[model samples]
Target: MKKIFILSALAFSLAAVAQNQKQAMTKPKTTPNKAVVYQVFTRLFGNQNTTNKPWGTIEENGVGKFNDFTDLALKEIKDLGVTHIWYTGVPHHALVRDYTKFGISNDDPEVVKGRAGSPYAVKDYYNVNPDLAVDPAKRLEEFEALIARTHKAGLKVLIDIVPNHIARKYEGKTNPAGVRDFGADDDTSVEYKRDNNFYYIPGIPFQVPTSDTYKPLNGEKNPLIDGQFSENPAKWTGNGSRLARPDINDWYETVKINYGVRPDGSKDFPQLPEGFAAKEVKAHFEFWKDKDVPNSWVKFRDIALYWIEKGVDGFRYDMAEMVPYEFWSYMNSAIKAKNPNAFLMAEVYNPKEYRNYIHLGKMDYLYDKVETYDKLKEVIQGKTMPDPISDIQNGLADIEHHMLHFLDNHDEQRLASPEFAGTPEKGKPLMVVSATISTSPTMIYFGQEVGEPGKEDAGFGTHSRTSIFDYIGVPHHQRWMNGGKFDGGQLSQSEKDLRDFYKRLLNFTVSSPAVPSKFVDLQKVNREHMSYDAGLYSFARWSDKQKMIVVANFSWLKDSFFELRIPAELIAQWKLRDGNYVLHENLYGRRHALLKVVGGQGTATISIKPSESFVFTLAD
Candidate 1:
């Protein structure tokens, strides 16, 4: 009788515990991910010229360093029609770890080619890159100011949040956090420990601007940090490559955001599965929960909150796919909960596979390359799309769900790169038409518009061209959608007009609704070409209240054409004047005209010019 009572009581206790855990695991609230994200590699995107000089350049000259967010620049981004701006690599790159070879330093650069590294190599967490921000307090304040301005202009802000890695370089002899040297023994509570078996000459960039950058303690920089800058370069370390993976995860947690996974595969914190008294599991969670805070995911949330507090709308996660989807879902949701209208996006090169993550509702967008390749191939092959525009339409739809759609990002070869296109100038048109009508949230990278020649070499082989601060081969004129080099009197008019033409198309996407809205549909025409009944490349979109048809000629030498026949049901619904189909068809000399015939088909006709994309739509 006693044994039976004990067993029954234990069962009841177990049930109670299970119910408590179930309640703790409430589904996280989320918002719809619908943002047109603009991804900017701050270093590459900005004006930093360090050509031929041995040292990094911080030009006090013209159009060089943007201390303040110019209305001209803001207007340019806004005019492009993007819903949000994702500024990447915003931390200070004042520390020139390289070019110490001959003697030149950051202060005396004869000319540093570009800006800083792609912003992924973070030297400090607190400040914006000086190359990008003229004044730390001022610039940050201005950045927030710009956020307010951008929103006023109908745009949002999304800065890059790198919770994964840090710059292999450092500024000042003092390591990050102002400690002499951090070791496991110095602070057992320290989540990461250096192996006694190894020695480390910590990476510390000498000139990280205090006014513009945060300073971490020693042993805190990434393994990739430039050891060459030190007296005994090789002696320093391989960005802590010797560090353990679990320790790496913990270090990343300290270094960035919510990265390290619980040893027992549970969430970090008071939130954990019941009965997790396992010593190792309990030990890992307890250590991180109490000791690790610098690189807390809450820290990432804090940074975002800081931006939002400062007035920038939000942030875009760099290489978001690498991080757990739950992290994004958490941060993104937290952000919206704080600001109902903030915009967020992720740079997952592909969106389909990441649906599980994206659909959970924190990532607002992703980078879409499917449309990129397909459109490029289409133009180059001179092939017409078949009915349903399956690839194009579906690609856009997927992006719409995740805020994808772009011409080029900082990580890959520029569409204008010869490897992708035959030459720089050849791929300009391909970039323009493809990105303009793409249903994904569209954005053009910094150098993409002008086809910056460094796309392939900028960050190739061993750690992407030394410094993003080194501005090499950036053009005088914007080369994004169209045009090329501009001389005083030579090719100036043509180049200017061509540039303006791209601007108009970009603006059209932003200002007009027909191109990106979900109402458009694709229809099968003939095997010769795929046709849309409405929107860009569409034959027509019709209903009782409105009618629209758009056609573009994507070929240079041939007269491209398509037809849309308005159905009799639609005509009856619209109550339009019934037209004799045969007469209109015969008179038009083309089967492509809306004609009310016996077949109840009012055929619509379309003709497109080489590389031309147009929209035709009418709605009440």
Candidate 2:
């Protein structure tokens, strides 16, 4: 009997110790910092104007008045608790082309016919258009001030940089090399086109692919000049004039840089589109002109570095895949080496290749295309909820290493379109999908949470019905993307509710990602409707020693009672006889007589309702 008594006493001691440990776990939390981010295209945010309208309709218009960039910043953004702001195409000079050769209407997509070209078709990277940058002289100060104000508001800034190519037509120089013509007439002769070996490709995209099209002007023998229309085959009396637009070469393509080959087989760097074509430039050796420099590319690295030093944290490298992966790695390291917290995001429109950017820490974030696309489809298409667990999980794995998580930004389809909204009733559920589930970092495009105002789709010649700019009387919206003015339609009360819903979720995500997992374990509460994405999810979090119970439910449907194993020791101490319950930290640690019943392992059952979720922190 004495020996039995001793054993019983020892058992009680261990239970008491376990209870103490459970209580001790609640030390306190400094709160986890959230990486939730927001992005936008500033020109599209404000008043519409006609003077800047390159298109006939508001949906196609994108140019905003230069001075409006600073005016659009409202108080709502800071209160939203986002850490980052991404602006699209700030410095793109308008190069609306006159494309009459295509035999399409000036208003047609084929004929640019003087419309605002995509900022990606930049004429110069250095200068901001006076129209966009109202006072060119004070532009830099204004930009700096904007950055300062953003930082003061507790947000970082991200600007887009298109490194692939520049606009040829908008530039003052008729030559593809962008050299000043200097009072030169439209002379298309051997002497006029090629001087000191300098020549540029013609307006035509693809006709002749060789330097053999080049011949020295006045028969001079310098390696510096090449000209467009080289295909004209100077004095090819051997045959008739082919009339093919000659493709002359230029120093920009041949000049080498700090990096290795220019990808175009010339010393010149940062030229031409990347990928398959760059490799093909190798087959025709005679087509390439050599200046006898071993191998060097343009000093684009220095330019990016200079930008980093000038108060920017990092860059969202446009077309990262077009550039060599090694260089991307080096650039990421370079920028971060300067500012440890710097983020270098990549722009990739593809969905399946999303994982590639995370390979070398080369990019802090590339939009999570799959998650956004799939979830949007599921919600908007009346299809069952998508089982995007794998996709979302893959995204989070990268975020563990500081990867950027997101929904929509400047490029591609807007998230607010029909692609994400099914019926007005499902809008809130869609918002939940966007803000929660996979637990990765999140981003929303500008005006996304607010609703997309109508604008004309210049590329497709259709109009987006969102016309908040028109409704709000934005002067800049009238100047640009809206072709001076527009109204996609009225904002529905449901849509407004959806926006508020997103704000709530955004605020929650920022706080929840920081939760300390004690006994919490997420489990599939039900697979019945889970495949259809119409089920509740239950997570079991327990403080074994605390002997408290926490039960939570997740779903966008009407239901009650989650099926879970209830631990007896935890149950004995507390009665979990109900549909839904939450376990606070204090309850998980406090001593109570009922806690005695919950020392043994078992399962607990809980319940949930539509669009509702729960969390339980069990204690002794």
lDDT score for candidate 2 against the true structure? 0.41
In model 1, how large is the Cα lDDT of residue 287?
Answer: 33
- Give the distance in Å from residue 317's predicted Cα in candidate 2 to where it truly belongs: 2.3
Candidate 1 residue spans exceeding 4 A from truth: 1-56, 59-63, 80-83, 93-115, 135-155, 168-258, 262-295, 350-352, 370-389, 395-399, 421-439, 446-469, 476-491, 519-523, 528-557, 561-598
Best by lDDT: 1
Give me the displacement of residue 254 in model 2, in angstroms.
18
lDDT of 1: 0.43
Model 2, position 352, has a per-residue lDDT of 44
lDDT values of the candidates? 0.43, 0.41
- Model 2: runs farther than 4 Å from truth? 1-32, 48-74, 97-114, 169-298, 349-356, 379-385, 390-403, 423-427, 437-440, 453-496, 513-525, 528-620
lDDT for each residue of candidate 1 in 1-620, tens digit (9 for 90 to 100): 00111122223244444343332122112221223456665544444332423222344211233433455566666654456777766654434334343232342111111233335655545556554545433644545555676667666777776644444333332123532221222222223322221123244222211212212212234333332232221121222233322122122111222244432344443322333223222233333344433234554555577567767676666666655554555566667766876666666655455564455534656655555455554554445442334455555555454545654566555555544544434444454445444445566665444444443232212222222444333442233312221221332444444445445445544433334444343344333345532223433433333343444443444545555445565545445454332111111112222233344445545444444444433333
Alpha-carbon shift of residue 155 in model 2 (angstroms): 1.3
Worst ten-residue run, lDDT, model 2?
Answer: 1-10
Candidate 2 displacement at residue 333 in angstroms = 2.2
